[model samples]
Target: MSNSSPTAARLSTLDRGLPVWIGLAMILGLGIGRLMPGLGDVLESFTIGGISVPIAAGLLLMMYPVLAKVRYDRLDTVTRDRKLLIASLALNWLVGPAFMFALAWLFLPDHPEFRTGLIIIGLARCIAMVVIWNDLALGDREATAVLVALNSLFQVVAFAGLGWFYLDLLPTWLGLSATGLDVSPAAIALNVLVFLGVPLAAGYLTRRVGERRRGRDWYENRFLPRIGPFALYGLLFTVVILTALQGEAITSQPLDVARIAIPLLAYFSLMWAGSFVLGHALGLNYPRTTALAFTAAGNNFELAIAVSIATFGVSSGQALAGVVGPLIEVPVLVGLVYVSLWARRFFTDSSTATSVAVPVTSKDSS
Candidate 1:
């Protein structure tokens, strides 16, 4: 008989077949978009203060359940782990943008609009969706939450300045023709407040109220289980809507999409692998290491898309570059989730073993 406990083997069918579900969702979305070309336009018309309402809802729904599962009270530990915090900041703010700028120029030097879009993508560090990736990889939840919140704060303050630097200053310095990106701090702040603020508040309040009323056991064991599956549902929903919206752009411009995708694939792979190695070298546990890797690898494609549309018209090549970001990111990052799980064996630490061996709730994830 297998040594696996009944509980360990009790993964929900959805959990077991996550890749299939995600693949089907993508196919379904592409089909919907292809069959109904007007659907994307109709969805685009519904917005709240320059933010897409449906996308915002799906993101919020995707995030809240994962955030609620975070042990907010334990965030102090993550904060105090200066190794993890400092590494995350350096990787996200410093190395990440610079690397993407290099890749954009190196890969798409002939395509100015696409290069600019990719640079913008790099500047907009991840403040959303990374939570889902982290949780799925069994990353440290408290660390992911704290790191994501930190990124949100930095995104609001640094995004515009960084945009100017990467788009204009650095190019001019290198004697290349500079592209000026006039992005507003307020718009980025609003995007952050809406996409990150709403779900963060809801999740915090959920844990606070649930634990206060029902105790931690009931909160985690009963309440979270009921809500845990919603995170994936929300993820699937967001994927469908987003893919549908970008279906036309994606299908029509296969060559351009391929060009954009090459750099993104490189960026994601390099950043994640580099961060994971750094985390291991720094002696971080597997969970924290995974958290660092995912946060560093992910990008705020939403902000990139919005800024591209606002700066260059919606039909511009820049917008298409922005549109192609998630098309590459979703599948690539999902693959990295499995890579992370497999790499856990190399960690060879007690915590890694325990996390892997434990029978956790749906919320505990991969």
Candidate 2:
């Protein structure tokens, strides 16, 4: 037998510890804000077009890697598995957002800013980290890749409309205060263009140019591995900066953070469970089910945070809630990976049983 150590496996897992890094970044950012409050203000002051330039850059960096990895060519083939696509889209756009809206109201009825922040998160589907979670759970990576690509594109159009409807129009109908809500579709579209559209176009261009120059093999094997870590670095840096900016609020109202966290925790769990059950009931196989579950469960907190800061001020409770979103999401999704893996056997076994129960044809005996 070949000598193979478990240490390698452990090390490999450690490399994927994004949550730990994000947590550390938050702590460091909080400390920096406490110690050098002036510096945080200066960083926040570097704004252009109603958005922080530094945070915008970080968001772009965080998004580009994942977007570049998408095989746009596979989009045509996604329709071949229409069930998977339909299920994912339904949960992501309809069930997932509506469920979170209810939870936010139920859990945070008094905190409209926090509720709005959560609503923004709900409107934006997962684009980046769902891929990681899908990989960890041995889900269908190709399906997820296609889904994410579609989601990224769809978000540019859908997010703004959904944000207006849920955050502004619906709230007004329900007699909720729509104060400070920038429900202007034009403004929302501009934010989407800045935060998502630019990065998406850049990622596509990078992939195309890199493939043309260095060849697909080199682009995938060499170029991708080298640049992929930048996304994580960007994410951590954004978390730190955002946390630092809001450190005073976080410090003063710890319970407020916990209150914001409650609905988020519920949203993640409910999304995952609902998607999994729906996929299983629809007769989706294990891999497809896992893909749906993970995708629906994960939120594009980066986009949500950027939009929150742009629409609501950086120091607004909305932005603070956006920051808290990933803090709850990263660890919860990581834990769900393990749960998904354990649940995989049950799905597989059910599929096996179904196959066995099918009758054999008499022509086979002849």
Candidate 3:
């Protein structure tokens, strides 16, 4: 039940083309902001209950297509691949966030806003791109699909609580000044509901309704193919809006953007290694191991950027940090894909050894 075949084609398109589009988005956004500052201001002023309505809408659109592709029915695999599930959860929630916190502190001690942004990035796990990464690496695509469903559900429940703990309570406990926004859990949860919950329900319903009307094959192949590009379009549109709003800040302190990127680069490298090592230690095969590694390493920048702008305002350094994330992440992950292909050879050799070492039975000798 892996949607790998369809996902593969779409991912190939995205892999080849998305970075160029994203770079153009940034440039155009910056141009718009510089050339038409009044327009950016007008858009930023359109908020609903303190959240930027345009960005929120873009976030929902970005998430919906990806979420709709998730095969919730395949979630039964959790009972079968329990170890993979447990390891993924632990790495994503526990180890990954903690690692990011340390790196942000170490690298950006004087830049609290940047540090806060990095922490937010760390807290939001990748729900969309992991499937692409897993498929490219020849990982267990079905397992990746299952984890994606679980991650989408988990983010709704845990993102707010964990954000409060890491960005607020934990900082206070350590006598460090908490630089995150002073929003309550209710506010955070509301944002999650608006951004994640609505799209998730819509996606699930879309899949169900489409299948009932058009049949499963048509739904998976035809309906999904038509809708899949929406997510990327939404992403590019959001990037343009974000950079337009933050163009002044980004232009004024260009080096700050590079400074913000350092911790992110370190976080990606460290988490990938940690997950890869842990997966092998747990005796998972290459496919499952790569799935776990990519899932752990990928961060949901769409959610992070939306929440940052909502919580801290579009012009804030925190929002700028969120914008810088995908700019760095897309290229880095593309390179990791090649690294994973090379690493596959080790797993192949391991499998060969196991087959050759099998004990012979007396019947074989006779």
Q: Give a tens-digit lDDT track for model 3, residues 1-366.
A: 234443232234454465587688889988887787676568868876655687777667766765676566765654488899999889888998899889988899899988999899998888765655564455665567667667777787788788888988999999887865544555545655676578778978997998889997786666765666666677677778777876766777789988998888888877888888888888888767888899999988767876787788777778889878876776677567667756766674333221111011111101
Relative to the true structure, candidate 3 reaches a TM of: 0.77
Clashing pairs in 1: none
Highest TM-score: which candidate? 1
- For residues 1-366, write the lDDT of model 1, one tens digit per residue: 242533223344456566787788888888888888888778878877778888888888888887788777888888999999999999999999999999999999999999998998899899888988877677888888899999999999999999989999999999987999998889999999988898889989998999999998898778887887888888889889878887777777789889999999999999999999999999998889999999999998888888988899767888878878877888888888878877877786715422222122363433
Each prediction's RMSD to truth: 2.7, 8.6, 9.0
Preferred candidate (lDDT higher): 1 or 3:
1
User: How does each model score on TM-score?
Assistant: 0.93, 0.78, 0.77
- The window of 10 residues in a row where model 1 has the poorest summed lDDT is 352-361
Count of steric clashes across candidates, in order: 0, 0, 0
Error of 1 at 47 (Å): 1.1
TM-score-wise, the better of 2 and 3 is 2
lDDT of 2 at 352: 28
Q: What is the C-alpha local distance difference test score of candidate 1?
A: 0.84
